[model samples]
Target: MAMGKVPGDSEGGDEVGFAEINITPLTDIFLVLLIIFMVTSSVIVQQAPSGGAQTGLKVNLPKGGATDVTARATDMSVAILSDGRFVLGGNIVTEDELKRAFNDAQQKDPDTIVIVQADEGVPHGTVVQVMELAKGAGLGQLAIGVREPQ
Candidate 1:
């Protein structure tokens, strides 16, 4: 049989090269993935509660517009949860541990600033008590954490 000719064919058809690429399926897959990603992202955004409070305990912090400042490496944080628990750098700590942490920080830098974040539900006296402990640990600088009123 001649090249490009059927078994009983007298005339041969024009030669055909490679077959055309089929992009429709690829395009469909890409579009489906894009839609899935878009839907998931939107759901995540919607499911997350706003107001910038992202902690294990719900803390309705007092709203105030204090001076906006960047946190320093030497700066320390003390959070007072609504349940009267103390959190240092996101970890729950006992009063003794809190005192030790402050002492360690003070040993490294005498002027270490202690930022106090107390929940609105927390009693004022407890916040003051933490501040007193920070002072006893030789920390000289102290700042309170408050969210900007919305």
Candidate 2:
């Protein structure tokens, strides 16, 4: 068999455009996947909620995984939900309002540790944001409340 001899070599468009690997299918699949990826990425990014209402539990997680059960949830803990709802010491606050609240909390107690308790449904990054806020407010340490793996 020759290289470009598919029924009609120079007559029809099929022979002229035909590739040995039939790249058209591959191209189509790649394009579809690209579109799917773009759409999915946007959706995933959009699903990250931003709000304020401290509902999640608060606890002083032991640093470096020590058996220090003496850690307590002082007045410096923010619990966030999947919908951006955050609760700071039983008080509801918006994401924007958290800064001032954290500042006040830090003032009251310089040794304050911001404990973050995010819902299991919340994205991992969202929880990080909560911790960052605590640090930004000049708190000593940020603690995330996590249940022992069962």
> Which candidate achieves the best lDDT against the true structure?
1
> For model 1, how does the per-residue alpha-carbon lDDT over 1-150 read when each residue is reduced to its tens digit?
223433465577564444456789999999999999998776555322565633443446899655665579999988999999999988999999999999999999997889999999999999999999999988978889889789
Q: Give the lDDT of residue 50 in candidate 1.
A: 62
Best by TM-score: 1
Superposed Cα deviation of residue 81, candidate 1 (Å) = 0.3
Model 1 segments more than 4 A misplaced: 1-66
**What TM-score do all the candidates reach, one by one?**
0.55, 0.50
Decoy 1 TM-score against native:
0.55
- The stretch of ten residues in a row with the least summed lDDT in candidate 1 is 1-10
